[model samples]
Target chain A: MSFPITLTVNGSAREILLDDPRVTLLDLLRERLDLTGSKKGCDRGQCGACTVLVDGRRVNSCLALAVSLDGAEVVTIEGLASGGELHPVQAAFLAHDGFQCGFCTPGQIMSAVGLLREGHAGDDPERVREGMSGNLCRCGAYQGITEAVLAAQGATARREDAA
Target chain B: MNRFEYVRAGSVAEAVAAGAAPGAAYLAAGTNLLDLMKGGLATPATLVDVTRIPGLSAIESLPDGSTRIGALVRNSDLAHDPGFAARYPAVAEALLAGASAQLRNAATTAGNLMQRTRCPYFYDPASACNKREAGAGCAAIGGATRLHAVLGFSASCIAVHPSDLCVPLAALGAEVEIEGPAGSRTVSLTAFHRLPGDAPERDTVLEPGELIVAVRLPPEAAGFAAHARYLKVRERTSYAFALVSAAAMLRLDGGRIAEARLALGGLALKPWRAEAAERLLAGRAPDAAAFREAAEAALEGARPSGEATAFKIELARRIAVRALERALAGTPERVPALPASPFSAPLANPLPSSGAIAHA
Candidate 1:
């Protein structure tokens, strides 16, 4: 049975007729909304390829049902930047070469943004590593990913201090 | 991920009534349920979405110093709560140890308790699993048993419950509040999960449509705040299931133990509490020799379900010792960077007095 659901994705109001309750938030973002930045790896909750921000929390979108998340605010990789300026996390990824195949980069950046909002990891390399353990890059780009997160966190903190 | 009627429960009473229908299951975060559905392990006709329930998401500190964690409270929320973490550091550590930050952010307390076994045989629909299909025969009985249970394991099923939070909850002697169509009742955390006896399919003691409303930690449970630690041993450096984890909490009177609480995880269908070990530790000095004896008592009835899993018994015993030793050393000012991993060195920073002391 189809359910009428509305969600704010990437800062835009999206009122949709969810024809199938089985459609996950990940699928809704990719298939229906045509926002394919969220990658699907291992459709199960194990892989963090489908990570996104739901109400300011980083969650595995692959496991979240779109119908149940009606009225929730979602932020995906596509929403990370504004006005031709790259998000600090995105810029850091570019600076550090955080991806080889780039399949897991979007999820990693979104998760890193969520992690920065959480503010528990700070700039500690160990905490950053543990915080980002969810998004796995089989390309063995973890060293670069860690450096990017550390750099982005430093940049964000400096911006906050200036503000 | 089958097509099912999605119901947003308006109230607790309405949720109970709607959930009582046949072929209906309560959906909280759907972290585990959706995974099972995709694997064809669980097929429910109706999903009672309980997330929108107003009061179920609260984390209340009762007047009596006991804490009531709403069933919908997310794992990361509970772990990151300064008061909750200060009072129950081991629980916070255990919570942070499980899954990734994303899963913990989305997964709820009740959902974590309701998750099924992680047995590969059970996940494989082709494999005969009594837990999946009653009377289908147990394939895990003779299959890859390295991660199987050692204690409290029945020949009927050898699968173990994969939860790090439940270990500390079991140690704290927490109680689970349940609401059904009839009324409300509470069950101890230890009694909430049933051993896989002849009926391997029934993982929990909850009657159908009886939803877990909240989990309560008694005021006295916070009494062990200074000396509580959860130690987990995993195959990887991080983000891996425990091979054999332990939660150890002690109430010390000077150099001697006044009381003790110990529970082992990833070892049995339920978090295996070690009452005998607790009894042995009381009035004794907290030492390696004492801990060794207590660890031995904890695994007294343990026997490998299969030959391949015999190493788990020794691993459980060793982890038990390390857990007790760490508990005596004292809970860290903050949760370790790597959480329950053995490799995580306890941070030396002094804990903020506000978040370290328990009211109880």
Candidate 2:
């Protein structure tokens, strides 16, 4: 059966007429809305390739049923940048070489942003590694990813301290 | 995934009523259920979305010092709650040790308890898995049985309940509160999950349309929180299922164990509570020898299938002992390193079959 869902995505109100209740939030964002920043890796909860912020908490979009979240706020990787400028996490990824093929970049960046907001990414490298363990990098770019998260966390903390 | 109708339940009554329909499944978090649906394993005609049900996500401390955790409480919130950690450290540790941060954020307490096994044979529809298809015959009986159960396993199915939270919940003696069309009822956490007997298809004792509302932990269990530990042994350090996991809680008086509780995961069809081990440890001094005896008591009835899983008997024993030792030491900061298996090491004579080693 078809259902009509209205939700806010990337600060924009989206009114979608969904024909199938099985459509995942990942598919809705990538296919229906044409916001393809979120990548579908395993299409299972095991891989965090489709990580997004649902009400400011990181969750696997591939596992989130779109019909279930009718009025929730969603923030994808595409929403991270504002006014055509890169977010701190994006800048950090660029500065630290966080990706090789960049297929998993969006998910990793979203997870990092969520991690920093959740207060898990501390100054410790081990903490960063554990915090970012969900977003895998087959390119063996963990060292760079960890470095990027740590740097972004420090910059965000400094910016907050100044404020 | 098959086409399904989705209905957002406004109240508990509405949810229960909708879920009472045939081929209707209540959707909470949808982390595990959606994955099963996508894999063509579960195809419910209607999905009753219960996430928006009011007051199902609150975690409240009762007047008796007990805690009532709502069924919709996310795993991450439960793990990070300082009050919950102080009252149930082993539960918190088990939650943190499970899945990943992203998954924990979305996974709910009821959802975690309701998660199905990760048995490869059960996932493959083509395989003869009794748990997935009744009377289909268990393929894991003679197939890759490394991750199968060692205790309370039947010929019908040997799959284990893959929930780290359940081990500690069983040890803590938590109670599950449920609501159905009739009324509300409560069941002991240990009795919630069922052993795979002739009915391998049924995972829990919940009647049709019964919805788990919350889990209540006794106030007395908080006293054992200081001396509790959870240890999970897996192939990888993170994001992997346990080969053998143990949860232990001990109450000591002058270095003598006054009371004890133990539960094991990845070793049985349900959370295997070591009642005999708890009895063995009571009135004994907390030491290596006493722990060893308790461990031996815990694994007394373990029936390993073959060479691949025969090692689990010993592995579970060692992990149980280590968990007890860590509990006594009160060192929750130290994560247990993965124990090396003797079978994994290279052998000098690979073809040796019961060959005696010559003394040099």
Please, what are the lDDT tens digits per residue for candidate 2 over residues B149-210? 89998989888889999999998889999999889999999999889899989999988889
Structure candidate 1, residue pairs in collision: none
Kindly give the stretch of ten consecutive residues in candidate 1 chain B with the minimal lDDT sum. Answer: B351-360
Best by DockQ: 1
Tens digits of per-residue lDDT for model 1, A1-163: 6799999998999999988899999999999899999999989987799999999999999999999999999999999899899999999999999999999999999999999999999989999999999999989899999999999999999999999
Candidate 1 residue-wise lDDT, B256-284, digit = tens: 99999999998999999999999999999
Candidate 1: stretches off by over 4 Å: B346-360
- The list of candidate 2 runs beyond 4 A from truth reads B331-360
C-alpha lDDT score of every prediction, in listed order: 0.91, 0.86
Residue B174's lDDT in candidate 1: 94
Error of 1 at A149 (Å): 0.1
